[model samples]
Target chain A: MSTPSTSSAPAEAGPRDKHALAAAIARDVPDGAYVNLGIGQPTLVAEHLREGSGVVLHTENGMLNFGPVATGDDVDLDLTNAGKIPVTELPGAAYFHHADSFAMMRGGHLDVCVLGAFQVSANGDLANWHTGAPDAIPAVGGAMDLAIGAEQVWVMMTLFAKDGTAKIVPTCTYPLTGLACVDRVYTDLGTFELAASRGRADGAVVVRDLSGISLEELGGRLDVPVVLG
Target chain B: MSAASILASYADAVADVEDGATVLVGGFGMAGMPVELIDALIEQGAKDLVIVSNNAGNGDTGLAALLAAKRVRKVVCSFPRQSDSWVFDGLYRAGQIELEVVPQGNLAERMRAAGAGIGAFFCPTGVGTPLTEGKETRVIDGRTYALEYPIKGDVALIKAHRADTMGNLVYRKTARNFGPVMATAARTVIAQVSEVVPLGGLDPEVVVTPSIYVDRVVCPTAQES
Candidate 1:
């Protein structure tokens, strides 16, 4: 239970480390975008968002314009993000009821929502909530609402599971969170964009970034056909 | 119409809650939870409760205390699996507690629908997910939406930062989650406020929950040291 000081923090990372990957995603966020960063890896994107980017963070628990995670004596249990981590409120922050908070998502007011996923099919189907293991407790939280609610859904995760299995697959074996809901995915290896939800077909995955791997090598690794962006 | 009664103590606030009542406990985690009120309900010994909240419970306080005491027969919530939710996890794994996991948005909207008197609404949040299985499905404007029904409660236990004697409420930051919505969706709404002001103290523009929706207001923090 020790906090890693600045000196102990990992060396300046390659473009594929989790923080770098988060930065890559934050770089592409349109200015003034209303974004909901999902729990886990997507949460780090908050640190990467440009100052004055006008990116208003929406925590489904009910608050907007939430600032980065709080520390020291600034933590207020009453002021927390969707992740239930105490955070500080930014200027122009507003709080609302849960009903209105979800309404913002369901009504498609969010410009982007980044989520973590177990698997993403080439067709853009998202499977993040459950592993389908019988003993695993199913807790969906707001993943389903965010996946389908935001104008664009981005995923952040490793390209492969701990077992060295590819996470991006021809079809998801896990229980689906939403059908054809993913717009982009940022992984340790590179960034990939799903075909538009409308005209997308099998093997239409587009490669937006590649780190330390050749296009053909990356294509050979994942089940989905990869095209250069 | 008469204003909400300003009850003196937490125990008296939940005195009439019957067993087997579906109680909506407001909170995201521990933020907006009416801890004293729930503790009072426990002391009052209302068992077989169906708890509806954002989270099942955390650690060994508040809602967790209720679950640990085996009072909650079922939990209708969005998320139940958390690091500190051992109380719920143990009950669920033992097949002792029923778990109904709704998407967070739907959980809120369903209660909103109950308060608004809407019968059922179609939502596209979980269209192709397992959560929508066996539910009514309709294709509107070419997109499929699963039909979801309202989730009304017998009692709502919530916490607010301040309340006027008229029961108009204002919340503190994100602790406001579910308090306003739960206020309208329950037959009997009880709120615990840190401070209660005289009538007309809260500005109408900032009153999140009007007095009509809140039946009882308790100042439990006043009784605390």
Candidate 2:
């Protein structure tokens, strides 16, 4: 099994930081898309979307066109995202009852939803809610709804776990949140497009990568083979 | 107009709740939770209670206080394990408290379905996950959906910004989460509002919940207590 390089430093700054990866994902979100940014790294996508981009942000708590994180007096304890962090409401923001807001989610009205993941199988199965650890407290928020409800499901996460385990595996060992739902996986290493193929549940191809990392190096870090396209 | 539904005190407002009753406590995290009502329930000391909400609570406040007080036997919610939900974490790990995690959308729809008198609905959410295990499934127009049942409560504890003497309610921004739907799904709806105005003080267009659903109203002290 190939291991992540242990070099202390690289000559150039690679796409290893969260903000850079977030920006990379933000660039692909089309204008006029009604998007739901899931908790954790997916929430960072809101800060990266172009200011004038017509991407309307939806929070399951019942707000549309919700703004960036709030600071100082702007913080309204009641105005928050799924992560329960205070957020400002943008101009033309509308609030509705929680059930109505979720109708927009589960009714397949959302265009795109970006979520974080613990494991993503080659066939696009997603597992992020629980690790099934005996002591772990599992909470399945709106992730299950967004994973299967949106027109497109995009996942934002690191390529590997802290223990050097590949998150994009041939099959998920963790409990699944949805099956055959993830369309693309964006990681600090690069972006991979998952496609349905014969004889394979799903085939992943690296569409973009950092300058410092080659396709061969990226492929070596995962248990499953990823092609460079 | 009919007699005011206003209750004299918090204790009187929640006096009807009994042990093992399923209650829908409205809120999204700590935002719109009926803190005063929860405190009353804690004081009432009803045991084996089933709580339905978006979250357990942020910290040692709201539903967390009730759980910390050992008044809750089970929690049916979408997000129960928040960062500050140590009280629930302790009880859950010790096998003292039971949890039924639902997707946020599904949770809301189930409550709404109950209020609307819908028997059951097929939803695309949780189609192939463990949430669908042992549940009925159907294929409509070549798309698979899991059958979900309506969720009704014995009582609903709701928080609103204001209510008319007649019990029509208006919510404040995102704090309105779950209040309107829970109001209709419960046998008795008890609303804790910050202000109560005369009938007609609220515009019909702005009223989120009509008076027909509310059974009682109370204005607790300004503090969360």
Candidate of highest TM-score = 1
**Model 2: how far residue A129 lies from native, Å:** 0.4
| Candidate 2 C-alpha lDDT tens digits along B2-117 | 53378658898999799999999999988899999999999998999999998887789889999999988899998888889888888898999999999888999999999999
Model 1 spans > 4 angstroms off: A1-15, A196-202, B221-225
Q: After superposition, how far is residue B165 of candidate 2 from its true place, in Å?
A: 1.0
Candidate 2 contains a number of clashing pairs equal to 0
- Specify the highest-lDDT model's number: 1
lDDT of 1 by residue, A180-203 (tens): 989898887778878443365554
TM-score of each: 0.95, 0.93
Q: Which portions of model 2 miss their true places by more than 4 Å?
A: A1-13, A195-206, B1-4, B220-225
Alpha-carbon shift of residue B116 in model 2 (angstroms): 0.9
Instruction: Give the true-contact fraction for every prediction, in order.
Output: 0.94, 0.86
